[model samples]
Target: MNGNRSVPSRAERLRASATLHVFYGGIDLMVGSRFVPHLRSLERSQWYSREALLDLQNRKLRALIRHAVDRVPYYERAFHGIGLSAEDIHSVPDLANVPILTRESVQNHFHDLTSDDWRRRHPVVNATSGSTGVPLKYLFDRDCVAMGWACLFRSWEWDGYRMGDRRALIRGTDFASKGTPLHERIRRHVERNLVLSSHAMGPTQALQYARAISEFRPTYVRGHPSALAAVGKAMLSNALALGGVRAVYTTGEQLTARQRMLIEQAFRCPVRDQYGLNDGGALILQCPASDAGLYHIIPERAIVEILRPDGTPASPGEAGEIVSTDLHNYAMPFIRYRTGDLAVMEDQQCSCGREFPTIRRIEGRIISAVKRRDGTRVTGLVLSDAFEQLVLTRQDCVHQYCIVQNADLSIRVLVVAGRGYDDTVTNDIKQTIWSHVGKGIDVGVERVPEIPASRNGKRRYVVSHAA
Candidate 1:
C-alpha cells in the first residue's frame, strides 16, 4: 500500500464484505490439469493466454453472476435491489458492475463461503497459517494439492532445481524426531533429505542443522525466510559451509533486501522467494535473480485479481488488495474472495516470454500497527527491518532482538544474548533502538537461548503483545 492510502471506512469495508460473501456463496468454482506437464500445456490454451486469462476470468465471472442471481440468497436480493439480472452481466468485462470482495466479508460469512457439497467427501482441511489475522480453515481436493506442489516445483526449476534433486527443507515437520535414529537416518539416506527442526535453532541446535546440511550436500536449501536468516547468521559466525546449495527457497514472511543479501552472501546462491497464503491460492513462485518472475497467476487452478480500496479494479501502477479464486479446490472454491494484502499489478510483458500476467510487488498484510512513544499509532510490526540492518560487528554480543509493543505503549525485547551478557551492551542496544523508534522508549529485555519461531519456522520481528 502507498504511504498515503487511507484505511477504508468501517461501512465501506462492511459493504465490500457483503458483496464478496454473496457472490462467493453462489459460484461453482472448478479446476483440472493438476500435473506440471498438463498445466504447462494448459498455459497455451484459452485460460492461460493473456486473452484467455482475461477471457476465462470474465467467463467464469459471468457464470458467478448467474449463480448469484439464481441461487445465492443474499446475492439474489442484492442483484434484484440493483435492478440487474444475471443476463445483464454478459461477460467478465462486465465484472465492474459487481462489487469486490473483502476480508470482512469472508470472516462474517465464513460458512456461506462454500457450497454444501464442498463440505462433504474429500474435503482437505487447510489453514492460512495465521500470518494474516483472518486465519481460515480452508478445504482443497487432491488436485489442489498436486497443483500447489507443481507450482512449487516450477519455482525450484527456476532456481536450477530438477525433480529428485537433493532438497534440504530447514523446517519443522511431523517427520522430525528427538534424534535421527537408525530408521530415521535410513529414511534420510533414501529420501536424500535432512529435515531440521524449526523450533531447535539455538546456537547448539544451529550447529546440528549445519552438520546435517553439510552432510546432505543438497542441491537447494528451502525453508521460511526468517528461519533461514537466523541459520544464515549462525553459519556466518561458525564458518559452516552451505556446501552445494545452488538455490535457496524462502516463503512465509516478507523477505527483506538485507536478509536476502545476507542469505545470498552466506549460502553463495540465489535466494529466491515464493508467495502464498494458503488462502485458497497456489504458491506464487519467482526466481528473483532471473527477473523473469511475475507470480504467474495459476490459470487452471486459481484466478487472481487486484482490487483497489474502494472495491474497484486497481490499474497497473496502483497498489491494491489481492484476491484469488481457487478453481481446483471446489471444496473451498473461494470465488473472487479478498485476501487482505496489498500488491501491485504489472501488465508489462516480462523479459521472459512466458506471457503470464504478473504482480510486480505484493506489499503484504499491514497489521503491525502500534502506539509509538509520542502517542501516535503505527500499523506494521516490521520495525525490526530497522534493526535487521544492524550487522554482527562482534561475535561476543547479542546480534538480534524483536520489539513487542504492548497496549500501554511499552515495548519488550526478546534477544539472543552474547557470552558476556551485561547491562552496558544491553543498555547500548536499548538506547540505539530508542534512538530509532524515538526517545522515552520503555524497552525491557528478555534473554533467551534463541528467538522463538512460529510452527512454520518464520520469525516475527515485531508482534503486538495484544496479539
Candidate 2:
C-alpha cells in the first residue's frame, strides 16, 4: 500500500466496517485499514532534520488554512474577523489571530460545526466516549485518520513489532461483545486478536487473564494502557509468563510513570506511550528510548499550538489549552479547535534524531477534574488511571464503576458486580483509595444495576460539571 493512498469512500468504508465489527476481527481487505504499517514507516523517518521537518510543516499548515478559509464556516468567520486570508497565514505566529473553538462549541453546534461544504461532502465521523465527562463527535477525512493511525503504527514498530507479528487488542472488548457474532469471531480468529472484557477484570480475575495471556502468547500487545496494567498486575501475582510477546503499546489513557514502570517490569519489555483523540490533531507520545522534552508531533499531519487562559499564544514549556489545525482533514477541517486538554509545546528536535515537533507535558482534561476531600483536585487522567487497572484486573466478572465523592467526604464506588466478585473487590478498592487519600474519610458502596453511559453512549470514569 502507498503511504498516501486516497482515503476510502465513506459509504464503502462504513458498510465494510459495520460488517467487520459484527465479528471479532476483520481479515477482509475491503474492510481492512492498513494503518499500522503506514504508521510504522512514518515514525521510522524521525531522522529528518529541523529544516526538513519545518519546510514540510509550513506547506501543510498553509494548505490546511486554505482549506478552512474556503470551506469551513467557523474558520470563514474567524479569518474574516481577524482580517486575514490564507495567503496571509504565512508563518506559525500568524495563527494567533484565529480564535480557538472549544469542545462545547463543537457539541452544541455540531450541525454548523463543519466547513460550509461539509454536508454536501461526506466525512468519516468519528466519536470519543472518553474517560472524561463528555463524548465528542468530530469528523475526519481519510487522510487524517490514516496519518493518525500511521503514527500509532510507527510507535508500535519502534517498540518492536514486525510487519507480520501476531497482535492482541485488550481494549474495545466489551463494546464489540468479545467475538460472539460468528462472523466477527471468525475474523478475529484469522487476524490473531482476542478481545477480552475489561469490565470483568479484578485482582483475582487478573490471575485468570494472565493464564489466558500465557496461552495466547501474542507477539505484541496493543490497546488501552490501564487495561495493560491490569494484565501486568495479574501476571505479577500468578507467576504467569508470556512466551513470544516482546513489547506492549498503551493508549486510550494517560500512562503514568508509576504504571509504565510496573508494565515494563511485568511484561519485561519496552512499553511505549501514545496520546491522541478520535478526532484528528495530535501526536503527543513518549518512549523509554528518549526524553526529548516535547511531543514528537507529526509535522505534515497537524499544526499544534498552546494558548493561555486569555487566548494568547503560550510560550515554550508553558501550559495552555491545546489548539490544532489538521492539514489533511479537508472534508471538515478543524481550524484552531481547542482540545480541552492542556500541554506545553516545544519546537526542539528529539534526541532520537526525529525532527518531529515535541510537546513537553500533556495535562489531560483538567476541566473534568474531581476534587478530593483534601481539597486537592483529582485530575481526570490521574483518577482514571488510578481506577483503570482495577477495571481490567480480572476478566471473569461484570463490572461498572463510578467515583463517589460527596459533600460528606464519604468515598465509595458505585459498581455492578459480576457473578463472583461483589463485596470483596469493593472493599479492596476502598482500602486502596483510603490509603492514598488518608483515614477518617467515610468509604461506602453503591451497587448500581449498571454504570450509566453519558449522553454520547460511552462510559465516563469521572463526571463532574465543576471546574
Pick the TM-score winner.
Answer: 1
Q: Kindly provide the TM-score of model 1 when superposed on the true structure, using C-alpha atoms.
A: 0.73
- Every candidate's lDDT: 0.62, 0.64
Clashes of 2: 19
Sliding window of 10 residues with minimal summed lDDT for model 2? 20-29
When summed lDDT is taken over every stretch of 10 residues in candidate 1, the lowest stretch is: 23-32
Candidate 2 per-residue C-alpha lDDT over 1-467 given as tens digits, one digit per residue, 9 for 90 to 100: 21122454677466544543443123223444444445444654566676876767777778778878787777777679878788998867777766667777777767655776664444688777654537778787654665676666566645554343467666644654443787666656655676666655455656776777778777777766556776787787678876556677777655665567768888877676667765547667764356543456666567777788788878886767777777667776676777777776775656665666677766666554555666766555555566656645766443556665655656657777767576677777777666656666776767777564443323445444443
lDDT of 1 by residue, 104-135 (tens): 66566656655455544366777555655456
Best by lDDT: 2
Global lDDT of model 1: 0.62
Q: Looking at model 1, how many pairs of residues clash?
A: 9
Roughly what TM-score does model 2 have, to 2 decimal places? 0.71
